[model samples]
Target: MKRIAILNCLKANDVCAGAACLKAFNSRSRHFEQYGAEPIELVAMGRCNGCEVGIDEGFQEKLDRIIEEGAEVCHLGVCTIKSETRQECKTITEAANYLETHGVQIVRGTH
Candidate 1:
């Protein structure tokens, strides 16, 4: 079975001003587990951490840790982008391809 992680780019509290992020995270968490993947590990960091800007050592460290342990995919909280600008569904789609090329699939929310 492949391990799956939830990708997020905000501090835990920032995930909620409303409820979209929480819903998306939980929904995907359950979905992946049902499909025989590891329960999603939320990869969140502080606002100062800039996880949204792209790769950083701290964030990369976490990703590396998961990947090293053989995480085969990441199911993003689709609503994450909704909560933020750069609704890069296009950038995200491209990123998914990139991640898959590196042998780690990046999936979107099912619900």
Candidate 2:
């Protein structure tokens, strides 16, 4: 099975329960279509620190957990890519870079 992780926008966490992302992953639709019917394991789900701080505070711990879980790939949720501010965009970039540096492939969107 392919291990996967999902990173969402911190601000959106309050209202978004991630149903869409999970549905897409479970059905192998949208950005997850590449996986086809291959077995997939969702190893982690986390959110960015927030636009003000980006990925600065406590993000390493989260990343460590994700890596420890054996996630080979990370999908940045749609909320992350559609961030409302430039700072949020930067946070998403930093999160993606951090994941990549640790050997996880980055997928721009989850659904």
Candidate 3:
């Protein structure tokens, strides 16, 4: 089975339950359409380290856990890309780069 992880926006964590992203993945629709009939597993659901601290502080620990769980691909949730400022976008890019360096394929959107 294909192992997948989802990285969401930290700012939305309090208000969002991630139901939309999960629904899209489970139904193989929207951003998850490419999976089609393949057997896929949702291995991890994580968030950015927060705007103030960025991903530099403790993000690596979270990434390590995701990797340990066998996440082959990671999808950046919609909330992550709906950046209100350039800094947010840059942070998302940095997160994606970090994931790539660790050998995980990055998918830009979740739902």
Candidate 4:
């Protein structure tokens, strides 16, 4: 059981970032919990305004708030990043790289 934080870039393309990200992260978290893995804390880290592709001030704000609420691992699974949007996907990869650099193990949702 690992303490994980799944991060959603939540960049804007069309869909609402907050609700969409929460939905994906929650679904993934449910799967992890079902498998008896340490469930992931869904952390939506990005600008709701869809300004930047990378985790920036908005990202820090969200991350800080979520951390204050006790969130840890980082998973990028927002539709913008994980499914359709290109920049968002890049953010996801960067997030994975950052998390690993920060000493967290980066793995897939199936893990």
Candidate 5:
């Protein structure tokens, strides 16, 4: 199984139902559809350290740790990218940059 990790939005967690993200990943819909046969093993699911105010302490460290644990791919949950709020966009960008800098392949979108 290919190890993967999800980076979600902390703020969206309060309001979003997460059904779309869950369905897409579980059913291999949207971006997930490209995986032909390899089964995805979700190794970690973490939220953006905090809201737009600022990234939480040790956010980068935590993300790097996920990769160290064998997460070859990191995905941004829908809440991190598709949300209408600008704060969400910032968080997404930040998470993407961090993951990329740490050499983790990023796959945008979950469900």
Candidate 6:
């Protein structure tokens, strides 16, 4: 199985219901339709802690859980990519970099 995950933006957590992402994957939209013949397993779905003074300490814990779950792909929600603030951008970049270093493929958008 190709383990996957969805990472959401904390700032837009209230606004984004995550329906689109789920719908896209559940329906096997183009974004995921060609993920080889192997079944894709959604192992994690979570949001960033928030772009504050710095990333939350628990952020590492969350990522650890995903990695432990054998997640090989992480689809970042559009909210994270379409963030309006620079802090959010930085947070996303940092998190993406971390995920990459840990061997997780980072898909820029989720639905």
Q: Tell me the TM-score of model 1.
A: 0.53
Off by over 4 Å in 4: 12-53, 61-72, 78-88
Candidate 5 residues 1-111, lDDT tens each?
878887888768778776676677788778777776889877877777676455566676778778787888888876675545534477668768777887788987777
Model 3, span 1-111: residue lDDT tens: 999999998889899999999999999999899998999999999898887877775787888888889899999987876556524467878878988888999998899
> After superposition on all CA atoms, what RMSD does each candidate show versus the true structure?
5.4, 2.0, 1.8, 4.9, 2.6, 2.3
TM-score on alpha carbons, each prediction: 0.53, 0.89, 0.90, 0.48, 0.78, 0.87
User: Per-residue lDDT for 1-111 in model 2, tens only?
Assistant: 999999988878889999999999989999999998789999999887887876675886788888889999999887876545524387778778888999999998888
Q: Rate the local accuracy (lDDT) of all candidates.
A: 0.51, 0.86, 0.87, 0.49, 0.75, 0.82
Give candidate 2's TM-score.
Answer: 0.89
Q: What does the lDDT read for residue 55 in candidate 5?
A: 58
lDDT tens readout by residue for model 1, 1-111 = 345555543544454452454464456434444554344554431221343555556655655565666657666654446556746344345445655766877666533
Q: Write the per-residue lDDT of candidate 4 for residues 1-111, one digit (tens) a residue.
A: 345565533444456435544564456543344434344444434443243536677665665554554445554443434454345455556556655665655544422
Candidates ranked, most accurate by TM-score first: 3, 2, 6, 5, 1, 4
Model 6 pairs in collision = none
Question: Model 6 TM-score?
Answer: 0.87
RMSD of 6: 2.3
Which scores better on lDDT, 3 or 5?
A: 3
| Residue pairs clashing, model 3 | none
Clash totals for all models, in order? 0, 0, 0, 6, 1, 0
Using lDDT as the yardstick, the better of models 3 and 6 is: 3
Model 5 whole-model lDDT (C-alpha atoms): 0.75
* CA lDDT, candidate 1, residue 19: 49
Name the better of 2 and 4 by lDDT.
Answer: 2
